[model samples]
Target chain A: MPRQRPPAIRIALCLAALAAGLLPWWNAREMAKSAFPGFEVTAPSAGESGEPAFFKKTVVNPFSPHKKSHSASLVRMEDGRMFAAWYAGSGECAPDVAVYLASTDAAGNWQAPRAIFNREKAMADLGRNVISVGNALLLADGNRLGLLFVTVAAGRWSGSSMNIAWSDDAGMTWSRAQNLTMNPLANLSALPRNPASPLAGGGWAVPVYEEFLGKFPEVLWLLPRGGGYDFAVSRVAGGVSVMQAALVPLSRTDAVCLMRDFRPAQFMSISSTADAGRTWTPPQATELPNKDSGICGARLPDGSILAAYNDRSTGKRENLRLAVSGDGGKTWKRVATLEEEPGFEFSYPSMVCDPDGTVRMLYSARQTQIVYVEFNTAWLKEQEVLQ
Target chain B: MSTLTVFLLVVWFFQRVLPVRGLLGLGVSTAAGAAFVFIPWLGFWIKSLAPNASIPMVGLLLAAILGRACNKSVFRPADWKAAWIFGAAASLMLYPSALGLGAFDTYSLGWPWLFHSVSIALFAGVGVASAVLLWLGNRFGYLLLLAGLGYLAGFQESTNFWDYVLDPLFGAVSLVALIAMAWRSRNPRPANPRGTTAP
Candidate 1:
């Protein structure tokens, strides 16, 4: 018979894992209570302007010469601009395809569509590859914008590599694009950092989910060093993928990122990184069950973390809801349904809380149309938390 | 780059590029070095194939490498069979694109032979080799031709070989199958003098 492993070793491992999982929760609740301070929503939203907050029928290619769109990422420029970037073409992997960007003023009115990146130029230099951008951020550093996304020059989606481009003056003027990595298929990206991330020796690091040869999803570091991930005993709050990772700084060695595990039933997944993003606490499930749609996360004024995603487990992004995490990310209570019924199918929630602490969100329904929701932290607190 | 650098580049490329990577290239290089170390195959091949063999063999080597890499390590050794099938399917996936109905890129053929032939052969061969290997198994010595065929995967610089390398959630499926295989391997059926039992 194969030698049975020692019982003590097994017990030790189990206890260690249990302790590791619980420690973050105990700490996060305290941090959330302190940081979130409180939250609410705006009474009259941009939707009041002839358009409702929810556009449940999004076209696959709303502006394409033909019409086929897929894969999107949303970000808030430091100037308080809301930009939604997505791939618009005949198909997800077609050549005529190009990455497009659209934005809304702080008031929530969307600008017209425009191309920001293309494959023709990418391949002319990087060899014939496909380039797609995701999660662009306007860092305080040099007021420089950071663009993170995947590129596939040699094959298809799997050949994806992370690449970036930047704009100095907000989203107006751009910078030459650069390759961030050679690893293909890096997905669902976000940059989160506290005072001590390893890349910054304790700063911000881009956290993107990777599901290559590996089973569970893990976030990798994208700054300080342009290499692989830094591993440790702890992990982000949960085991999830296409994770909507948002960073909230509470203290040194502690931060909360609102995450959604890819589980159809277990909606809310939040992870914490103690020694920066190098290691994370296993994510815990919340009352919110994911509607099988992607979510987006951001920080608010009073220190609360804002997360938007399909609230239900079925149907469309229709139930896209906003909730605040008062206790770091340990617990979440719903704020409001940015989209109500007859307006369901509203999904792929992307959110950003302005400097004044006001909240804004972008989403699409039926994959045919796009919509934006405007709210205030105060209005949200009045609404019920989904729990 | 010099001939030596290109050869060295080939070595590193094979070792690093492919997703379902096998040490076949490294192993082959070692074997060749060993031939020179003793048997005289490397020196003989060098004298025989020389400069002309470099380009064609490089392309074949790419296809074989990709073909072999896509074999088992790419997916999980257990589901190497499925991945082989998928890869073969992908290779044959040449549909009506920018090039009409023809396989390989007509664009490159208009440009360079080294670029064109290598690109088409590797892409087409990998899909064929992977499918043939899995459905057929190691029986026909197809795997023997793997490293030789892998170089073909990247004949066109723009080719997306990562599908064979990383794939999407296929890795997770492979992980499950591997765990099952390992578990099965560990828990073997005990022999009974009395013979058969329930599965």
Candidate 2:
């Protein structure tokens, strides 16, 4: 009962349809041509291999800071200058919270940390209603200092997203913020805790986590593209219980991820990748205890791993300890106790190894101050013998 | 791209708010879109609802609604129904795993086409679906084609292919409408004595 459309029009439509279908496939094929050339891992070289150096100090803001501070991260710049960042406010997820940054001067004195970003700045830059800001991580990309932090828009931690900003003049001034579209649905729940590790091609493998629907660890790859960077995310493992991964690249083709355990197991989980981060073994529990708190790790010049985490099985973040692993994180031996007071909290430890074999550590002290600790393999060797 | 989506969505909202009778209403809609961007909290609320939704989806819906409000039929009811069914299916295939119901994340497969074969398969599936829609003479097929081009141009903040094709809000609406349509089909209104249904 209906007159048919012309066959010529249908033919034209089909040809156009074929082109449309091929366009995305063509784009995808072109994109796949530039596969990641593996991580450009730089294990600490044996520069001054046997140097016996040990240093410890607490870098705090001279002015009156916020009531609470947590998630401290440290990065060594190209000029060998050390910079630190952490978020502080009335409480976690509080509207008053702001990300703060500090750098050590030539005289080795830590300058007062100044507020680098906050909810108001986020609201203004993002043109959205931001509820709070938290979990700031500092990354060194050549001479540029990059800060990745979390901004909550509507709800609690579940309603959060990640934003990145760069400072070219060593944290004196920062560029405008750009949101990382980690999720398309309201861009919810992507948080960065640990600083990134150097990849093979002058790129960075930043460790971040998701906490909204499920808790899991993911790696955000910032591969150099022309003069800027291309972003990609690879899931370390799939689960609802492990998150806040600390990625430590052991070689160009090998890395281990340390994850915070949110399950009843209460032990830190470990996953390894033999081909950069393209694929990972499902996380298995390590002997190290983790009570849903943050952890960090770095590779020493001796091919050893030094990890800092809240070492407890009873689910209290009152004790922070250092552990050394020679078997690629399969086992760990406690070397030093950095903080131990049952009534107080000292958690969220972030560690990084300097080129000259100096291990710098940072963590929240009593949830009120950011504490910095430095040591060397000489100190670690001594602690190992003592243990 | 985000700013563009915000502008388009705001224009659609303005049409609803003003609801003037003809093509003249679009002038009012443009004025409202320009003013709302500077109005601060209003823009944020809209973005907070669906921040990273596909641009073509929003743009197409806006065009359809405006055409009707201006007494110009750009899309028939069948075109919208087809789009709803397509979008709802895509969402179901993604959100369950993305929300952590399974061990694998469907969302991560959208990062690029190299690491996962699933992405290529999904892309090819979309291509086939586009061809089928075009063959059926549905205008929603054009939307699908535009989404593919937009994806190639990186028209959205997200590089994931799924983000350019489907979003949670659109998926939710499509799913609800499909369910209602199914329910109504199962229980048709009784025919009037004059062989017409009551209004």
Candidate 3:
């Protein structure tokens, strides 16, 4: 027979196991608390009426430079200036494809778009022949602006890899590119479409998706590491085939993602993460109709979620609509129509709420130009009344 | 021709020259290399049919040369058993998790800290195993060493470690071999019951 250990040793071993189990749980809870703080949702008052006002501007000319241009992203700089980026070339994934950047002055006049990065520059910097480059996302981290994009290595999208270039001078100059190595296969097909949402714990969560062999949606946490940012990836565990997720935080530890489903679900898929996007619940279909196109969202000042998407299931790429959720995306009310016209394509929407409660939305108009629009709660309320 | 194809052909020719010791091996190796290189349709067909299927030229060459010199097969029964075990274990671990049927996403282990640690441990384990096999006079040790070296040198276009170790073709072959072995073992042919009574 084996000898029995002392009570103290047994107690120690039990305590060790208990600690090992509870420590990660405690850490995750604390991280979630710091990352997302709960916000009170104030419902919009009824019967309010006023003359709604908004400003609209075109950021780029699609016909002069490139035949096709899309996937536009916008970021507000530290200097109170707005910046936007998109890819343009003969077509998507073409060798001549390049990323273009534009900025608006303090007077809100849009600047001419210029080529920021192209295939030749990327190839030269990486010391390899880059087949194509696209999916340009601009993220503002304090004083630095981080540009994330994808490069096809072996002349195929399945061989795609991600690269990052930072600009400290606010889009004036950029540093050389560095490989963002997440997958061993170098096949991180997911690209960040919307700007990253900042966490209270000195990090930001960016939504990305993978569509190589299958559709796998994931959240990438960009934390400050040394002088630059490093990524910690967590899969969004939805059994559905979803991609290009738009994340909306509901509380300090909880957030919801609206994803684009590739399959003919005809509805925007929804998934929630309670631990600051470390993991997510399985995705399910939502009430909002989607046409297998990219959508974007941002939290309003009054703690409401605002989403912009093409609001039809089986129609032409027309009628871009805005929806508002007061109960943290549990229920949404279609508040306004931004664009509605036949024989036109309006998709890939990105939204941002300014300090003065102004909602700035930038989206591609017919794959020809980047359209920027500004409005507020009053405008949404007025439109709601009109409907 | 791609640089990789050219490089592989040159290595194959050099390996053949050592064992055959004549112009015949050189000519044959050269012809094979030329076919793989100059024929665009052949390359495209191979890629389409079996995406990651490139012959393990170094391993085959080493096996052939050693078999010729020693007048015996380079791969022993024990070597085949090892290959089967490696293949089965890899497929079991990779396929299900890759398909998202499992709880843990094993592909995420490709990230740096975990990736580096696992790769280093695998290399060390293979080193010890190969050393033991070589000490026991098995040429399969050379094959394992060559594979490890090829992975480290980025011999293939892929950066994935799994692609270096086993592709779909290798996995299927090993699985079939294991099944056949199991069947033979379980249903052994009856011995000549009437000893020496048959014609």
Candidate 4:
């Protein structure tokens, strides 16, 4: 099997074989899904290489730095080393908090965790709203790390904005944390994005959600300017009422923003732009199934779309799930449960597919634990089975 | 499946099986299960409790008591050592690919350790499920096995466990093991009664 075949032939054959074997997967297709021309999904038999399993765990408290910890995000670097960070809180949503780090070998085993950045200064400078820095992250070219998190500058869970941090040495040392917000708002998160993929100007979008007056979520493009996050926000909406927006990149000139109505059980609104993230049309309600639950959306390379959400407007956030959009964001069919019953709280789920094809999903349910799932273009392309 | 079909399925399954009481049982057991997986310190304790799962774990206590009353040989044991061989081979093949070996990569290229750990748990769950399904008769067993598998592909994955949970490997291994066991049983050679067989 190894010697008889030329190296290139073998490589091409394997790729072709996988692409062919995964014929059942439709994500490779475009237009009507039957339009897929080049690649096919190659799902290995269960006992084969595609089998699904857990990677490894890092308590983040490996150093037992603080008395508590919660809300973690993981990133696998170019070298196959896994880096994880989380907020160490004295209690759920507590003020005495700081984000920490841990690394894993290629096999996924975790190393001891350390404090990538502390909250004492941010907490003192801005008050305790700067709880922990990275509940979400954006890793960039040249080994830069971008993170955003929520903190209360005013009241509990009240004040939130974006903050950015980085480590050239994977936490051996990190640059000092800086705020990503233009001015302080209620809350913000670095909307997750794929790595090694370019942005409009080599900068990435840090999703900021506001709470005060007219405080809404905006897609803020952050470029690594002058060794800090030089940030700018796109008006996700004029009113602070429009919040919990889902973003998807269609092309260099287009992006989709799915904004939701402030009222519960209402239709989710959409605001899209043909000129990249510069501007978006006014949001209107859509028939997509969103149980007033928060939603996360992403664009598949095949032009199909994926949204993480609940079925009805009132399903438990942990009852949250995945839905696919075959025709842009026009409609969606519920795909799979991001988290199910026994763990009925997988909320605020963040998803990103790293360059190596691993899809990372992070969510906080029953106390801020991240549940990650991965599949090739093949698995996702399977005829969706909705609930 | 359509939304209506799934809605019906959920209603039917939940109405029939997920009673308030069952929900409570699920809650308690699930919490226990989560502790068993997430708390690394308790792994040995759980492993020691479920050794020799010749039968699956769910039915162990009942099966032990019933073993004395029931006839020992339900079906002639087959020569089933092949199951282990297939299982080990499958493991060797899939394990490396998952561990970022042999240039075959699925997810887990970049992920947090918790995500990786959880991905392993999902596959492990699929493994245990397929094993139990194997004894429940073949046609429906394959269906349950697929459901177990679907649970796996549905989640982002990590490199851990045998890349496969319940799969052709299970069927292949079971076939071999059963055949080996039957061959041994049909030609039972009297050991020197010391519980050792060399002949």
Candidate 2: segments with Cα more than 4 A from true spot: A1-25, A28-34, A43-48, B1-39, B63-73, B113-117, B197-199
In candidate 4, what are the lDDT values of residues A1-387, reduced to their tens digit? 112345565444434323322321222122111110111122222222353433322233434535445455655566766666666656644556666666766666666665555556554433223433434454545465545544434333334444555667656765555544232111222233222123643555544444444435555554544555333444555553456666666666666676655656466666776765545676767676554556666666555667766556445454766677777677777765545675356555556554333455555555444344555444443425324
lDDT of 2 by residue, A1-387 (tens): 123358787667766666655566565555554444565545556535676657686756545467888888889887778899999999989999999998998877798888999899988887767889999899888779998888888788898888888999998888888888776567788999887888665768899888887788888878767687777776787668799999988887888999899899889899998977778899999999888888988888777788888887544798888898989999999997777887889888888887668888888888888888888878877877776
Question: Distance from true position, residue A83, model 3, in Å?
Answer: 1.7
lDDT of 2 at A379: 81
Off by over 4 Å in 4: A1-76, A91-93, A110-113, A121-136, A184-198, A224-229, A354-358, A381-387, B1-199
- Name the lDDT value of residue A107 in candidate 4: 68
lDDT of 3 at A277: 61
lDDT of 3 by residue, A268-317 (tens): 77788776565577778878888788888877767777888888853646
**Each candidate: what lDDT?**
0.44, 0.79, 0.64, 0.44
Question: Native-vs-model 1 lDDT?
Answer: 0.44
Candidate 1 vs candidate 3: the TM-score winner is 3
The true-versus-predicted C-alpha distance at residue B27 of model 4, in Å, is: 71
Residue pairs in steric clash, candidate 3? A36-A252, A37-A252
lDDT digits (tens) for residues B26-131 of candidate 3:
5556566666655644443333223332223335444544554455667667766667666666666655555444334555432222223333344444455555
Q: Rank the candidates by lDDT, best first.
A: 2, 3, 4, 1
Alpha-carbon runs more than 4 Å astray in model 1: A1-83, A103-110, A131-142, A153-156, A169-174, A182-203, A215-244, A313-316, A342-344, A382-387, B1-199
User: Which residue pairs in model 2 clash with each other?
Assistant: A39-A200, A40-A199, A40-A200, A160-A189
Tens digits of per-residue lDDT, candidate 1, A1-387, equal 123347675444434333322332332333222221111222222322222232222332344453544445555654656566665666655666666667665665666777766676555433323444222332333334554445544345434454556666555655665554322222212222111112323224444443333223334333321332211111243222435455554444556665655665556666666654445566667666774456777656555667776776445555666776777777777776666665536656655555555555556554545555566655565565433
Per residue, candidate 2 scores C-alpha lDDT tens digits across B35-142 of: 877675767765655667775477566766578467776767787788889888988988876665554567766765446455656777777787777777777877
